[model samples]
Target chain A: MKNRVVITGMGAVTPLGNSVAETWEGICRGKSGIGRLTKFDCTAHETRIAGELKDFDPLRFVNKKELRRLDDFIIYALAAAEMALADAGLASGAAEGERTGVIIGSAIGGLATIEKEKEAIFLGGPRKMSAFTIPAVLANLASGHVSIRFGAKGPIGCSVTACSSGACAIGDAVRLIAEGHADCMIAGGVEAAVTPLCVAGFNAMRALSKRNEEPEKASRPFDRDRDGFVIGEGCGIVILEALPRALDRGTRICGEIAGYGNTSDAFHMAAPPPGHEGAVRCMQAALRDAGMEAAGIDYINAHGTSTPLNDAYETEAIKTVFGEHTRRLAVSSTKSMTGHLLGAAGGIETIFCMKAIDTGMLPPTINLDHPDPTCDLDYVPHQARKAAIRTAMSNTFGFGGVNAVLIVKKFEE
Target chain B: MTLEEKVISIIMEQLDVTREECVAEASFIDDLGADSLDLVELIMEMEETFDVQIADNELEKIRTIKDVFEFLKSRGTVWQE
Candidate 1:
C-alpha cells in the first residue's frame, strides 16, 4: 500500500519577509513586497523593478567562509531547508538519518554567480576566477549542497522545470516518501535571478512589468491594468513525512499533500495552448488523484502571475475546471503581493494554501482595482477575507508551458 | 607589518582563522581546518599581495605556517621580520 504523505513543517524566505510568520503576516495584510529593482542598475533594461527580499542575512544559514563559496540561490535554499528542519524537530539529527533526503528546485540556478564570474573571466584569465564558481553556478548544486550539509543519505535531486521547478521538486518528494523510498524529505524551490543579465534578457523578451512609478501596485493579478509580471527572488521549503510514522512520533501535522498533477503543454515553448487545455487536464487529474471533487476545494491560490496572458488564461482555466463551483471557490493570487517568484512560486504558494486551510483566512490579490471583464471570478481582491477554507489548491505554470498543481487539506483523523 | 605578520594576516583573512591558529607549526589542512580549495585560495591571495608567484611544484612543500614565511623569505622580497 502506498504511504500517505503529510507536511510536518514549512519555512520560507520571500520578498515579503524572511520567515513563514513574517511572510504570512505580510500576505494576510495584502502587503506588497514588490518594489524598484535595487540589485543592479536597470538604466538600460526596460524593467526597473523586482521583488527583492528585505533584510535577508545569509549568515543565519551558512558560515562566512561558506557564504563566499556558495551562490545566493544555494544560500536561500539552505536557509529555507534549515528553518524547515528546525520546525520539523529534525534539525540536528537530519545529518545522521540515513533515510532523510533533500531536493531543491530552481529555474536558473546561480545567475548572480554566473554573471560575476563571467565578468571576472573576461577581465582576467580563466584561472583568475574564484575556485567556487563551478559549484555555485550549477543548478543541481542547490540540492547537492543541502544534502551535503544536512548529510541526507537517501534520494537527492534538483528540478529545473522552468518556473514550475519548486512544485515539481515537492511533487517528486511526495512520490518518494509515498513509495517508501525515504522517511523524510526536505524539499522546496529557490531562485536568485534578480541579476543584471537576467533582467536585461527578460526585458528584451518584453516579459517584465515596467511600472516603475508605483512598484507596489504594479502586480495587479486578474486586473485589466497588469502590464507584466514583476520578477522576484525567494525560497520556500517544507518537511514531508510519511503519515503513519509522523503520527507514531506525535508530530504536529500541518496538512496532507493530498494530490499533485504535472502536465506539459507541448503546444508552445513559452505560451500556453489556447484556452489552457493542458492546465484544465492537469487540475482535473489532481482532483482525481486526491479522491475528491472540485466542490471539495474551498479556495485556490491561483498562478495569477499578473502577466496579461497568464492571469487571463489561468482564470479561464479555473472556470473550465470548477464550472458552477467557480462562484463558491475563493480564489486569489498571492503573487499579486509576492510578485512572480518563478521557480519558487509553487513552494510559497503551497505554504499560503496551507495557511489558508489552517487559519481559516484567505490572502487577497492586492491591486485588483479594476477586474478584467473576461477574467470574471471572485478574486478576494485588495484585502484578506475571513473564511473557513478546509481545502486549498495551488497552481503554478512555467515558461516551458509546464503546469503543476498541488492540493492541501486540513488534517483529519 | 613584518613579512611574517603580513603573510599571517593574509592567512587569517583567507582561511577565516584566528591569530592563535597561525602559529609556526600549524598545518593548513589539519590544524587550521583548510581544504584543498582553501589552501589554493590562500596561495593565490599571497601571490597577489606579495607580487610573487609560487611554482606549482612548490605547493606540495608548504603545509605549515612557517613554510609560507620561509618560502617568501627565499624569494628575497623586501620586507621586515
Candidate 2:
C-alpha cells in the first residue's frame, strides 16, 4: 500500500488575499478581487476587467533586484511558498535541506516579461534587449527559484498544462512522497498573466467576461446569465508531508490527500466535450484511487469558470459521475469569488476544499441567481453552510482538454 | 560618500539588506540571501536605474553591492546621493 500524505501547511498569494487566512477571510466575506486593468490600457480589448492583484508590493516578499530578474509568476510562487514554510514551522529547523521537494507550476510563465522584451526588440534593435530575457520568463523558473530560495534539495520540477498545471503539480508531489522519493513536498500553482496580450487573446476568443461595468458580479458561475471567466493572478501553495513524519514532528494535519487523477480529452483544444466524458472519467479515477464510493464525498469545488459552455459541461460531468448522489452532494464554485486563477485554480481550490472539510464550513458559490435549467445540483448558493464534511473533491479542466480531480478528507488524529 | 558609495547603497537596497550585511567581501549568493536569479535581476535593475549597460563578464565580477557601485562608477556613470 502507498503511504498516506497529509497537508500540514497552506499559503496563498491570491487575488483574494496575500495569505491563506487573508484569502479565506476575503472569500468568506464574498469580496470580489476583479477590477479594471491597471497593468495596461485595455481600451482596445473586449474584456477590460480582470482579477488583478491590487496593491501587491512585491518588495514585501522579495528584493527589488530579485523582482526584476524573475517574472511576477515566480515572485508569487516563492512568496506563497515562504508563507507555507513558515506556517508549517519547518522553515528554519529540520527538513530544511534534503528530503524536501518543490513542484510549483504555471500555465503561462513570464508572460509580461516576454511581452515587454518583445516590444523592446520590435521598437529598437536587438541590442536594445537586456540579457535577463531568457531566465526571467520561462515556465520552470518558478520551481527553480523556489528551490533556490528555500534550499529544498529533493526532486524539484514544474508542470505546464495550462489550467491543470497546479493540480498536476500537487498530485505529482503527493505521488512522489507516497513512492518514498521525498518526505515532504511544497506543491501549488501560480500565474501572473494579467497582461494586455493575455487579455487580448482571451478576449478575442470570448473566453473572458465582458462585464466591464459590473466587475464584482462579472463572474457568475452556473448562473443562466453566465458569460465567461475573469482572468486572475496569484499563487496557492500547500506543504504535503508523510503522515508518520508529520506526526513525529507534531505538525498540524489540515487534511489528508486521499486521491488524485488526471486525464486528457484529446478532442478539443479550447472546449470540453459535449457530455464531459473526460471530466467524469477523471473524477471517477480519483475516487477509485481513493478507494471511496461516490456517495462518500460531501462537498465538491466545481471548475465553474462562469463561462456558458464550461458551467454546463461541468454540471453534466458531475451528474454523470455522481448520478443520484449528485442531488445529495453540496457543490459550490469558489471561482464565483476568486474568479478563474487559471493554473493556480486547482491549487487554490484544493486549499479551499481542504479548509472546508477541516472547518466544516462550506464556502458559498456567490451570485447563483437564476441557476441554469440544465444544472440541477445544490450549489450552496449565496451563503456558507455547516456540515460534517469527511471527503471533498476539487475539479479543474484546462484549455488543452486536460482534466484533474483531487480528493481531500479531514485528517483524523 | 563617493559616487561609488551612493551606487552601492542602491544595490544594497535592491538586494534587501544593510550596508554591513552586503559588503565588498560578500558574495551575492554565498554571503547574501540572493540566488542565481536574484543576482541576474540585480544586474538588470542596476542597468536600468544607473543607465549603464552591464556586460556578462562585468556582471560575473560583481559579488557584492560595493562591486556593483564601483563597476558602474568606473564606467563613468555618476551616482546621485
Highest lDDT model number: 1
DockQ of each: 0.64, 0.30
What DockQ would candidate 2 receive versus the native complex? 0.30
True-vs-predicted CA distance for residue A247, candidate 1, Å: 0.8
lDDT of 2 by residue, A221-261 (tens): 99999899999999999999999999999878888999999
Which residue pairs overlap in candidate 1's backbone? none
Model 1 chain A: weakest 10-residue lDDT segment is A89-98
Please list the residue runs of candidate 1 whose C-alpha ends up more than 4 Å from where it truly belongs after superposition. B79-81
Q: What CAPRI grade goes to candidate 1?
A: medium
Candidate 2 regions exceeding 4 Å error are: B1-81
What DockQ number belongs to candidate 1? 0.64
User: Each prediction's Cα lDDT score?
Assistant: 0.89, 0.87
TM-score of chain B of each: 0.93, 0.75
For candidate 2, the per-residue lDDT at A236 reads: 93
Write one digit per residue (lDDT tens) for candidate 1, span A1-413.
88889999898999999999999999999999998899988787788889999899899888878888899999998898888888888777744477888888999999999889899889977767887888899999988988888888899999999889999999889999999999888888999999998888877777888899999998999999988889999999999999988998798999999999999898888888889999999898889888999989899999898888988888889999999999998999998888888889988999999989889899998999999998889999898999987899999898888999999989997
